[model samples]
Target chain A: MSTDLSVPVFTNQSEEELGGKWGMVIDQDLCTGCQACVAACSMENNIPFVGETDAAYGRSIQWIRIERFWQGSFPEVKMTPYQPMMCQQCHNAPCEPVCPVFASVHSASEDINLQVYNRCVGTRYCANNCPYQVRVFNWRDYADARVRPELVTLQNQLNPDVTVRRRGVMEKCTFCIQRIRHTEDVAKSEGREIRDGEVVPACAQACPADAIIFGRIDDPNSRVSQAGLASRGYHQLEELNLLPRVTYLKGESNNGSNG
Target chain B: MIKKFFDALNQPLGRVGLLIAALVVLSGAVWGIAQAQKPPEQPIQFPHKLHVGLGIQCLYCHPGALRGPSPGLPTESKCWGCHQQLQRFADPTTPWPTELQKLRDYVQQGKPIQWIPVAQVPDFVHFVHRPHIAAGLNCETCHGDVSKMTVYENPQVINMGWCLNCHRAKTEDNSQNNPTNDPAVSAMLAEKRTKLTDCSTCHY
Candidate 1:
């Protein structure tokens, strides 16, 4: 038997990590659509609110929205709720190729489809390219006098790291990039690897059902990757071939159980 | 001849008038740029030097800084924690700062301070100071040097790319830089090839 004295060390760096495949696995069985995640995400990322008029017209600037659809009618009616919709962070993102500016681009480091707000000139080419209708346009200044009166007061309380967007621009989800960065920074500073339950977003942290699972796609043992592999897990609008990073599990039938 | 007559007709006076108009436009542009760059001032003169430099943690007055969306404004009772005694020595007649006096007046009359916030993050972004603190980031990372400042000053420009860059750098898997050694990344990675690119992570 040949004895090897030197121990091999695995570094976080790898060539395969350059092109990211970021995706999410949401357990429909666990989802209640309580809107806590929606509120939490909005507060964390600084999403502007549309008053009664805009909300009535479906013009709200929600980076992630809960999409509810009715499958059947009357006697067999089923109203299923799908939540946390934003850019899918697609692999062959249609939004990416069309942008006049490089505002919408896929990140090489991770599978994240990034929307660089400062680079955006509000041409809204990315919005037209998206198949999921995840992109939102800001029609009016959220700071207008009629909107949330407490909004200005609320602004000062924001996480100083994130930007507060102005009106007349297109903005969407960056997957809590601030939190992800903060967690990664913490992990890096300690000279250790990023572990589970440490990089939770506001919505995931606030989620009562633990419906949302977040992690690196490369780790085979990660909860998100396993959930992605589940039999019921599937992507939204899969036929479009946008290759969304977010995955959803089929809603469990509550039938036969005591209602 | 005729060409010279037309050239003189549109001559030095016309050029001088155009130059004067251009100067007016340029000055107006300068004023507009200056106005846009100016940060709005807050209502009260709340000094961090008087509070934090004397060994006050952020949580002491703004108790909700850890639990919820905001580091809420302190109540009159919270001010009384120190001022009940300190007031007699500093200014027995005026009591603590006028803001605290106003808070006491509100409490007596059953009202709350109509405080105007100094740091304004737009409505779309969600930021939790608690998680950062829990993750071991100092309160000073985003807040700037609070301990050294006499009064709060708007010193940072938190644009979108700024946030994305920080997030990108932090998430870059640098073993030399990680501070808290949070386990969620590996747990997220272990179950599968985990990628942090869900829209729900930041926007909803």
Candidate 2:
């Protein structure tokens, strides 16, 4: 391993050429900004609601958030299409190299970025280094029923598949890895490859307009790959060479409603 | 007061006393950990030896293990169905054991018996028993033989290292282990090894 930080040590040009195993394509045009994906993500991943005060402090632990910007000014102002942002699951993730412990890592099998919660020591370096700013840290024991009495009843609704993270742990979107693992296991048991559309993340499943599409991007025949081939599809931070797996389709303002 | 305490520690006797205090604290911590490792007491003293001796299979009671992550505890009705037909319970002349009496009370009250799970992994570890079973692992492979024991207890501490040890053993490509050296078998083993050792496999 090279000590010189200027040169990337773990960069795999082959992986970049081959493309990622799992990929997502989000159609910004179809997104209604209803926050359905946000709600579903929280429920599915056992994400704690950090109350109004903490949320005001920008400490809300939402894995995915809808980001929209205003264009022009005053009467001519128009809202840009809702861009639901989450962990990009970059092939060469900037977050992976910064962790003091190997908490933020790349999964060899899945070919995706992983945050091993048990290995995390609350350094927050990964969160700071993340270009997408998707990583969220648990500043308080927000999930504990004793700390937040209101969560006592809500605790029952927690998905047992996902671990309820405690204070001082950094977490981000896992691409609903639990669902991926479950579908893979089922497919393996039946002696067949995982079919396209079999594994659906919480956000993709809850989308009313079916804006989110997740599948094997390596497979050219897969829906996600077909969607990624569109001229409008582009990576969030393509200049940095992060090789993010997520492809966002540009929303045209010429839909006539904006005028 | 702090100065006086440090001055006292300069004496040989004070040093001996400090060493004794340190030893006492260390032993107390060790004892606490030992107690934590002990199997928790269940509501009913369910005898595994008696049940296994009577030729009852583990799957009969915990059927969920075959299909899903949790091997669910049998319902009280399942217990009563057998106990009600037993010669010991049918005859009024025969006296019921204290444990059997407790079971009877629970069934009568329509209360679920609280069975404390002995073998458990942390919340971070997502252990699915279905794959292990599908891989042709007997119940006794991870869970020790139940026929010899009374109350259910883990054969050993269920930790990440222990899980990895078995995973490594099965996946190792050695000529002695793989006599045939079949390419297909080796390929399958290699794939299994990668999946098994991957952190995301157990931890999400």
Candidate 3:
């Protein structure tokens, strides 16, 4: 309520320890980039179908997507690395600032960026500020009963844990916060901490190659923290020192020439 | 005259006046009716005071509350479970109470008692009962002193602001590890504070 407009950067250790830092380690060597994670993320998160023309206009809303890059252009084709890119969940998330309505803020407890759909005034400042470009803006009334009648019938299929965002609100991957809270509540009721691999995000669970590893990085024994220490472990835009929680191991070798 | 009417709207004070008038009408008619001004009509005059006075636990009838999202209205069969015993214990000369007889008739006809929900958050809100109960919040915290009420009255204005206020209060108490709460529970309670304010925590 105070006039103080400071946005928390999710650095305070005590807060983070209580809620814990949620980090992901993607083993590029194990990832085949089958796009299963992408598909699963879309379904679980209720990502929109912008259609061909809208997508061509660069309006596709994919929280987690398979980004493919062809390395070489010759007869001796080089390795094509398939990376699963989503919200980096940076500890020093740049997108937290520049929100006029304070919609985009750091979850001090969880150490992840959260965008409150109801609070968002749709200035798209968060989207512009995001270095990862993962934030999606709803330009029109798409998810409502007015535009998509089939969605009205399929409304029951929508995850009860996630709210179907209305128009003019910005939204993105929350690391399936609903799932995290659910597990956290359940674990607390049972009087125990959430076990590793017990609470998996939609994308991580659907990964056939087991490339995506999500766990509490605070725990030294957790898969994410352990895999993050791998020799090839690196982060996107590492020079910027955004301190992205997603650690990616370098993928090398094995090119199946489909040509 | 028509031009003067439009000119009046152009002035800031005039606009403010119109807004005030609109708000008064809106608050008087819509907001007044929607909230606590008038208690909702119930299908049955089930008195909480009588049951609570007789030493019946709130959890006994609201068993689902301890386990799940909803504290459902007691089913007719559940009522019958106790009422049958109560009838057997009553003196043979004394006739059954009218309400009890009505309940018996309903059970015999296989009709359920349609007790209107006293506390209801919107469909979008996933207000599960167990977590609050687990966090040591009794039914009275939100529902008020239901044990004293004949008809369930929503004493607290159940709104987002009301929810946030309580959450902030708890957060302040737990954030620094208050001596009152259990050390382990204090940490969990503090952690829960962050989630409580999160829009997705309830809205989702």
Best candidate (score: TM-score)? 2
> What lDDT score belongs to each candidate, Candidate 1 first?
0.67, 0.89, 0.79
C-alpha positional error of residue B114 in candidate 2 after TM-score superposition, expressed in Å: 0.6
Q: Please provide, for model 1 over B1-204, each residue's C-alpha lDDT reduced to its tens digit, 9 standing for 90 to 100.
A: 989866755789867777888999999999999886675554445678768878988888877767645788776566656765663646656546576665557667866555566565565455555555665767677778887775566567766556556555555544534345557764534322223333323432
Per-residue CA lDDT of model 3 for A202-237, tens digit only, reads 988999888999988889898888888876777887
Ranking by DockQ: 2, 3, 1
Residue B169 lDDT, candidate 1, scale 0-100: 54
TM-score-sorted candidate list, best first:
2, 3, 1
Identify the runs in model 3 with alpha carbons over 4 angstroms from their true place: A1-20, A48-57, A74-79, A254-259, B4-46, B73-118, B122-126, B171-204
RMSD of each: 10.5, 3.1, 6.0
Model 1, A1-259: lDDT tens digits are 2566675464554323433444567776678878888888878877767778888998887776677666667889876655556677777688887888877776654567777665677888888878878888877767544555756776665655566666667777777778776676567557688886577877778789888887777777778888888777777788765566777776446321111
- iRMSD for every model: 8.1, 0.7, 2.6
The list of candidate 2 runs beyond 4 A from truth reads A1-16, A73-75, A251-259, B1-3, B7-16
**Candidate 2 vs 3: which has more TM-score:** 2
Clashing pairs in 3: none
Q: How do the residues A29-78 of candidate 2 rate in per-residue lDDT, one tens digit apiece?
A: 78989999999999999999999999999999999999988877899997
Better of 1 and 3 by DockQ: 3
- Give the least accurate 10-residue stretch of model 1 chain B, judged by summed lDDT: B191-200
Give the Cα error of residue A55 in candidate 2, in Å. Answer: 0.8
Judged by whole-model lDDT over C-alpha atoms, candidate 1 comes out at 0.67
